[model samples]
Target: MMESMISSRIDIIKPSGIRKFFDIVTQMEDVISLGVGEPDFATPWHVREEAIYALEKGRTNYTSNSGLLELRQEISRYLATSYQINYKPETEVLVTVGASEAIDLAMRALINPGDEVLIPEPSYVSYSPCVILAGGVPVAVPTTEKTDFRLTSADLASCITDKTKILILPYPNNPTGAIMDRENLIDIAQVLRQHNILIISDEIYSELTYDGEHVSIAAIEGMYDRTLVINGFSKSFAMTGWRLGYAAGPEVLIAAMTKIHQYAIMCCPTISQYAAVEALRNGMDSVKRMQEEYDRRRKLLVHGFNEIGLECFEPKGAFYVFPCIRSLNMTSEEFCDQLLKTERVAVVPGNAFGDSGEGYIRCSYAYSLANLQTALERIGRFVARVKQA
Candidate 1:
């Protein structure tokens, strides 16, 4: 193979830091994994049943380039009902493989070479990589524990430049579980409105919010036109394997995304589309039940960490708890590695999310309370030993 055989585009980037530790865990036995940000719940029975019915009926063919119209319409209605944001199913929505694909589509469709994408630090691992792969420059704007990992307008404004093209907003954020309320969004919206930057708001964890309702920045005044709201059924409905997600945005952007999606994917899995329809229609009760369970785990983990001397911040949304491990006198990676090797509990190093995450580690509370209880006990022992040394 020639030196240039691999695209320089891909050669420049690094593999996900989240997966590095996870890969090690796969070969280990009796390890309790709090690393991956996946819901441990099975897909709701009704949602699974719907997918089975679709397969039984041989609904295995490809959908329209955008998606099954019925699924899109249901997504439209669900967003309207939940977030007060209206997205026309016909022209403003396009279903993709997952919110990951939706994020890529939005970036690729909107970016030009050398365009800067403002990404807040300690965000989902994929955001900056996707921006880079889309030929956009990823400018990481740091957010700190001092602000509960919330990206303030001041932080965002400081990074904007003449070359900035997009803002990747990942609230109900992955590692930190930080959320921006309506007032926080309004302040950020005010700053965004002054610039020509487009907003790619990844709200995949929207349904998992614990405090007030999840507010879409797209719903904020002056943001609708400039925002591409990315959401999907993976996190909310525990349908990660279903690979179904959709993007709601301006017609022109949607059209561009659909064009790329058509060429790249043609359509999402037809059976999954049917199941997503069921999810948006009749799965709210199931979602609520899961959310309630996650709330319990969230509270338990937050309190347990604080009590055990890790000093965790209370996360208002999502299933992960980020605990400050700086007192242990180790880097995030060293803390995670030592904990996993010694106690058989796997958690991700916070720096895997970004530089600002250096003093912390991300542990998902999506596991059962029993598993969480055991993991915490082991972690407590590990923390005590580290502190004494």
Candidate 2:
């Protein structure tokens, strides 16, 4: 009736900014949603077949708390071979229900009450709430479009305070599509070491980079011991619904995360773990192909935004584009609502991420080519009408 003596913190939590737009758009049956941050593709046939085969073979029961041994080993090998991220399957890896659970586990494992976790602004909405729910404080560090929305060493250095215990680094970031390159990562690592801050690097979109490559901060010397790497098949292999992901870090940190996960999560879905293993073993090709398609759409969106009078940075990774809508003289929310009301194209306002996101709107390019074309035209017309008004 009253959420069973719910904690005051829970009451203070706002619903996800990204999710709130869904209700508005869903009521309009004809609207095209470019709002959610997920791939539009289905899990590949081969991966799905593996899951079906597992269930058909009567493999429906629970697996180990960490995960099926084979899946953890496969993920260990995949990270090393693909991204040069070395992890020990036995002691350094823990599987959970998607990267979201991993984020929660990491916060619970590392944070003491009143500890501060630095999260970059305009990031996924979950970071701050999870920090607060774990009795930790969230210190938001703003990243601007001038830097391609990528968090830099200066930003990291400026945000570090004595109470800071963790930093959630969501790179190949959502909404902005910015990536931390080898150099930026190394510089940030230096600052982190200086402040003795632990890093929770969210690399779920590692496989989606259109830049040279996705480099894990954990791959740097000495950084591995201080970094918890969160990754999953959701973005890379189009397996969002399967709800499988894992974290790799030092044995001590990983063991703590495993303990929390064992009690709270038990294990990831068994069938999904089987499929994720297949993905790790032989799914690089699919990732490469999908990235190529995303690259094409990324270029198209950048060009379309510029032509339509919105200034946007070209995203080097991930599938979303953040376009500045201040020229319309309306807030991001006003712009998105007006566009949706008249043209039936749904997008998320930049402030959905953080206060720093006020004058922008995030449009995901995970849509089909035809849908993107139509959405862009509608947005263009909306811009023209706003100018005239």
Candidate 3:
């Protein structure tokens, strides 16, 4: 009887595949987890100090429904300086609890019932479920290792239909760590130009790009007006617990999202908003330092996986690497489960992200070099045993 009270939409969505492994790890000892997609570093001292100072000063009142104007201004300046895209802080930005909230707001505000949202798989798991909850159809446009898991113009164009309302561009993608460079975006933009689709570009990992500077699709000539860029302090600034993110786009869309935000969220935490202001203003040097460390680990993990006979692609952004395990003749889940039970190393199964990720497993390098070295050794042993079997 209680089950009947739940919405069918809620029933249809699977629990997060990433969280499933972590739950099991919590019950076990000596688990070295590469399953989490969080930065292992502490939030920078200055940013944490700002939060502490805000608490000491008793500035705990709710900020504006749109968020603190000062923080929004910093976000505007940061985007302009970092990505060469500009958004008016006053009318074009709405602060939320995290990029997660910003994504939810965008889907709810833009998706009419039955409208389809295009998501490139394998992707961060939230995109499809969020679209479903907002009464939108989630359409998967599968990407492959052949393109370094980056979405192509052809695949994107083929997925569009008259009912298509939004395309979620999750670059420096979670699970995959694939990034779309300027040349790649130009090709994608050409296909989008002829469509009426809006873009929700989740750029949470923007600062973590290891190659050249990260490019924003919103910076493309015709994209700025239609693209809502979602970003936050979590991945780059290591402020996951602070729970602050924002959306920058046209005033009309921002206004619409803020309306939903006002009713649903009211405002982001006051202390977090204050800390985020400091993160944007003075914490970029800390981000650079963290990026340097992540790049080093990224190289180590890629090399280690390849040496162990897993075919790993070098990812230019983010701290995760998706190594193919097809040659082992087991499913992604089977490999992850057996590795965890045998070697006590925790990595996420790629199928947790989407169907296209079935033959891969995502390993985050956001761990100490010692832990990564040990995990690599354990994984190598597991691979050998599986091959011998």
Candidate 4:
């Protein structure tokens, strides 16, 4: 207050575009919100029971700084079984507060001042800000709906410079629901192998893929040593409130991330770690049921948007539908605001994800079919009214 005590680095970061809209949604009555990228389902019963059991048994004490060895071993098995990637639970796996914390830790451990971090845009919101906070320059590489929002080797080549240090690979991407297949990752890997860059692959939505199995870049040849795979129980296991995630990679980088995590977080919540262990070991049936329901909502929302003239590309992963709203002749923010004020149906403006997202709006399909139907009806009315004017 005396002399503007906030550091310039903190000043440079913008508030999350997602939460900014969500704040407004909370104030309005009967507003059907499609804004937040959160699962609408409750945490699976078995997983919740595990946490409850932990608390009942007085399992409230902190585990090792690297997190419970049992949980890490479960994470190791889950990764190996699901993705054919193996990480030693003892040395290579470090559990953290969430994938959010893991992402921050990775950035803090890897970035040097003025280093460049290539973030594929129209992706998750946290990547850029975390890089800036870590003293790195964030270079947003735009990907288009033309290629289904997948970052290509050519795109990688164009953005590379001597200063590029880390590439944030967010697949099964947020906002757009785009996923990078093996071929897409292989192309990008070839380009990255030539550079001294490391990769932070956020695979939080890996289990939510609708088309084929999700691919992790670390499993790709020539990439394992250079890739830190960030994943968690938040998305796939419907455990967002649990605050548990883990990172696996070459021990060197994992060790570095663990060092920061130990100082910053020490470990995740003890009960959440127990819940997540149950999630890894036995929550697949619940995950499948949720994914199936989200798929139903996804189909309904995409069809409804197209019928209303908001043409949305079918997203192959995650639970969001990014639809082009440019034909309505408004900025994404303007469109979202007007829609909220008029119909009370809330979705985030796509620009919240990146500037590349300006002409679109991201509608999450994680709600009930009844809610989705109501929101869709209201949105259709909004689109018609705008077009007629």
lDDT by residue for model 4 (1-389), tens: 94588777777898765676677889999888898788988899999998899999999998998899999999999999999999999999999988999999999999999999999989888899999999999999999999999999999899999999999999899989999999999999889989999999999999999968988998999899898999998899888988888899989888888889888888789999999889889999999999999989999999999999998999999999999998988999999999999999888999988999999999998899999999999999999999999
- Candidate with best lDDT: 3
List the candidates ranked by lDDT, beginning with the highest: 3, 1, 4, 2
Which sections of candidate 1 miss by over 4 Å?
Answer: 2-4, 16-20
Tell me model 1's lDDT, rounded to 2 decimals. Answer: 0.92
| TM-score (all chains, Cα) for each model | 0.98, 0.97, 0.98, 0.98
Q: All models: lDDT?
A: 0.92, 0.89, 0.93, 0.92
Q: How accurate is candidate 3 locally (lDDT)?
A: 0.93
- For candidate 4, the clash count comes to 0
Mind giving the per-residue lDDT tens digits that candidate 3 earns over 105-197? 999999899999999999998888899899999999999999999999999999999999899999989989899999999999999999999
Q: Return the lDDT, model 1, position 189.
A: 90
Query: What residue pairs clash in candidate 1, if any at all?
Result: none
Error in Å for residue 214 of model 4: 0.6
Per-residue lDDT over 1-389 for candidate 1, one digit per residue giving the tens place of the 0 to 100 score = 78768889888698765676667788999889997788999999999999999999999788899999999999999999999999999999999999999999888898899999999989888888888898889999999988888889999999999999899899999989999899989999989989998999999999999967899999999999999999999999999999989999999999999999999999999999999999999999999999999999999999999999999999988889999999888999899888999999999899988999999999998899999999999999999998888
Q: Which ten residues in a row have the lowest lDDT in candidate 1?
A: 15-24
Clash count (model 2, backbone only): 0
Query: What's each prediction's clash count?
Result: 0, 0, 0, 0
Worst 10-residue lDDT window for candidate 3 reads 14-23
